[model samples]
Target: MVIRLLREQEEETENRGKKGPFFLLIFIIVFLSIFAFVFPFFFGFLYILGFQKVMGCFPCTGQSKKRTESGVNNDIKRKDQKKPTSGSLKVNSNGNLQKEDAAKDDRLSLDARNSNLKDQISENEINGGTKFAFGELVEATDNFSSNCFLGEGGFGKVYKGHLKRLNQVVAIKQLDQNGVQGIREFVVEIVMLSQADHPNLVKLIGYCVEGDQRLLVYEYMPLGSLENHLHDLPPGQKPLDWNTRMRIAAGAAKGLEYLHDKMNPSVIYRDLKCSNILLGEGYHAKLSDFGLAKVGPIGDKTHVSTRVMGTYGYCAPDYAMTGQLTFKSDIYSFGVAFLELITGRKAIVQTKDRGELYLVAWARPMFKDRKNFSRMVDPLLQGQYPSRGLYQALAIAAMCVQEQPTMRPAISDVVMALNYLASQNYDPQTHLAQGPCGSPSRTGAKRDNDKAQIASDGSVRD
Candidate 1:
């Protein structure tokens, strides 16, 4: 009995020893789990203190203090430390914030060097003749970058610029120094624009005459020239609608009327073409590039004799043959532009109907036959114009392009006619059902309207 009790006690002691290791293992696991969970937060707190020390001091976090009080002075200090790479920021002339970096590039001075040229243009010639520095123009045009270049005109290269001082976008015409003719035009434009201010006329904002550089600045017209919309349209562009065309014509005529009748001396627009007529927003047209403008004959005189200069197909028959220029010559040119608008063809097109290369010649026969009036309308119009309106427009264009300048209607008369035409209503939904020639249930009309409709993005829709 004594031996059995001793064996049983030994067995119990062995089981207790085994159970001790298991409890120690469990204790170690619990300690490791607790340390793993709390270590992240403890390390984060230490790192934040080290960050505060590295950054000089801890930012105040108090509800009582104003929200901006802590960083107000700090931000200003940081800004002062950093040197500006462009120019100092300041409120511009138009109450807009912009960099005035042009001052750094103002290297040319107009004192004594071009005294003779300066004398030609007296201070009294114009009240406050805003003379822009060459540096300002250079900076505005980004040193006349190719991308900003608008086009090559009769004067020189034109660049679209943003004048920081004026806080406005403007078109800058820089003269070609090598061309002596450009110099005369530069002076003429500056003098003419200085005195003339009308809604239809392009406003010359300022001019730059530093050293050999001669630049004329004018307001930017976003829609570009009328010629651009008329010819060589880029892909995905719709043709100008008939109503828009009439409005442009009327607006342009008003500009000529302002120059011809409203001005005291009665200025004549010697150069009148689609290219010279610039369009603005909503296709509002304005006459531009007045380098070739000449004062009309005074009083009883009929014409002014000058060198023959203007676009080919647009010049009047009388002016082209003889150098005698009259207000009638401009009327003839306007007729050509009117014809182009009607035909949706250029005044001078290449290899187009061999003998009918000139739009005026091709349209002449069509005008003679009343039934052929529909043929003159632009196919791009998709037969959307009123028949009577089209006839009236064609009649006006025909009279303006008469072989005799005497037969041509005055610009005022033309304006009156176009104003009536522009007022005519057009219903595209109703017109689309008819043919291009206004004949009902015609397959040809439906086909043409369908093609134009597919290509049209509501540019012609009223």
Candidate 2:
């Protein structure tokens, strides 16, 4: 009985020892599993907190990056603006005193514009010019009345207004909210016109800027634009006389000459259409709209590479094709305008007459033939223009419209030729009289025939 009791006790002890180790192992596993899940939650919370702090130190978020990019773009735009100087002209002589006096006036005007621009645009961004009260202009223009409406263009509508403050008749050009010309163009036109003061160039009286409201005030042109008289005339208005056309051409040429030759660094008048040529009382022509003008190439540079921008028919062929602009490009455009005056035809025409669709294409061949040269002259003149003067005018036009830019005459040379034509007298009967053989009809036919005869005789001998 004693031996059996001792054996049972030993077996129970062994079982107890094994069971204790197995329970301990299970407890350790349960603790480890809970720790694994809970630790991830705690670590994630800490990581998120640290991420916020890091983002605050360095702007790496999408919104912060976009703001940084916008700031840089604004800085670049501000830098590109050409701020006008307070004193643009210097007084060297009595001839320049008038220009100096005008500069003083411009300076005063600029101060006014700067004051007004302070509320809307940055003072540095806005160039110098006169700032008129929008309320005053509203009153002058009869509350933007349609009766006062004169015309409309790519910029906006123009209205004839009587400024009570200045006691002056002014033409107000309001900016179109949806027009091609925007703030950049408005500022450019104001700054350019402020510096340019010439009899043949339209004058900027003042301008009004109020938030989105933009208006330019100019001297009222009673006779309206040359386009109106030349192409689209109002009822009862007589067709422009030959002398008047000549005068307009000469004056317009002088204005271009000033832009090309007189201005420092020279200015290329990109848009030189008939409509841009405004006429004051007594048929005085003035070049209007300088928004498209660019500073010409300087320091031996042949041409300025620019995106081709101008009227279709007026753009120089080479400039249009290659985007290389020069002073000669303007000369080519001027030639087209001169042709418009001579032919009384539109720039781009679709006619039933074969080979005469475009004014330039049709006129090119006629310009070569002496007898057919008279065909190029405007029928409106009623054959009243001086034949010698017409010949001189056509010759200049031919040289200007040459396909080769180098062959085109300079604006100064064109001005000189025009000046002579303006001064020279014309006798209709004598100019158109036929020669002894009636074969030489035009003024220069006889001389041209003589030259041709001499050339033919020499060529035959060779």
Candidate 3:
């Protein structure tokens, strides 16, 4: 034929160029499997429209009104520039709008220092305090009524009202909106009980605050808390007498010697315990909670580092292992509240008798024995104390629980040794007519003239 019909047209043009690259490799494997399944839903819809246009959440049109008028002209050129001072920081470029403008300038400087703390307690005129009206303490606490409560703590509840607009009888308190005290311990217990005068200290006659309420008032007391006449004594009550527990331990050491030698920046009460002392009609004592008062280390600056806080068997083991504090950390929480008025005991107790769970480690081995000082008194004072005034009040509560805070003493020498043991009045019928062998060498020369007038007055050494 023509050359075998031109060899069947050159084998049909080499099988049409090998079936055109096998249909171009099956359309590039179905366009790379539909671009790896629509490239992650179009890059997650352009990363949710660039995170909703960098969080402004873009909805206002005209290009977000020209980007909110160029962010209000860059916040009026950053309020005409030179700003960042309060100890400077200011770095921006949107780190979540610089932490929402540093939490709106710390809530507008803590609402301008809580609106200048009621004009700094009305320009510090404080004395018998005032500022009432939170509807006159809700009509003098009748509203807080549960039969006008009168107890509850950690910074809340207490009641006993009757203030028909200062017709008197106060004591309110309130606070506790999830308590542990706040609003900086209700402005430090109204600026430390309004310039703390002191019949042993608790008076602040008024306070309220209103919106988000607070309250305070005071003056009522009527025989309460010296941990209610020393550790749970209700059923037949009475127990406080050993000359009213050495006159409420010499009026709680003259309210810690008027806050460590009459305050003028000496006040470190920092929550001394025994339910913050209190008591009133006749069993007088006072020092009521100045919400962890602090201000001590003035001038020479011996301590006040701070942040330890108190009451765990009454703190001070070197201010709870070095937070520093001082004024002997309120004389080791007034020697664990004068050893809970000489062992009516309960400064952390839970005893199956394994070395008696801490009342200053069970009075530190009964203060190295003076016949274990009548077995550490307060067996409800049945021996009617005065075994030489219970060995000089357990040697001034063993020099105010000294694990050496410069060996404790000085709250004006624990108010001159508990005001000479509350003027020595223990007449158990003149100590049973001076019976236990009355004049042992004129009672050992009046116990060496009462330890040389308590070591010449500034006692508490060892």
Index of the highest-TM-score prediction = 1
Estimate TM-scores for all models.
0.68, 0.67, 0.35
Off by more than 4 A, model 1:
1-123, 126-128, 178-181, 352-356, 432-462
Q: Model 2: per-residue lDDT, tens digit, 237-354?
A: 7887667788888999999999998877588898898889999988999998776787799898989998888888888999999999999998888888888998788878766766
Candidate 2: worst 10 consecutive residues by lDDT?
453-462
| Candidate 3 segments whose C-alpha is farther than 4 A from its true place | 11-162, 165-167, 171-183, 187-207, 210-215, 221-242, 247-269, 273-279, 284-287, 293-305, 308-317, 324-331, 336-385, 404-425, 432-462
lDDT of 3 by residue, 1-462 (tens): 999889988889889988999999999999999999999999999997986677554344334567779867776766745453221245576632222344334221242256455443432333336767777777777788788897988888888888886698888888888988677666767777777788988888867665677777888888778887778786977787687888888898888888877877678887888888898888888988787787788887898887898778888888888898888888878878888898788888886757448787777765664445556667776665566666677678777877888877788877887788889887766553222322222333333223312232224334
RMSD of every prediction: 25.1, 13.0, 17.6
- Error in Å for residue 397 of model 1: 0.7
Question: Over the stretch 251-333, how does candidate 1's per-residue lDDT look in tens digits?
Answer: 88889988888887788788889989998888888898887788899978999998997878988889989999999998888
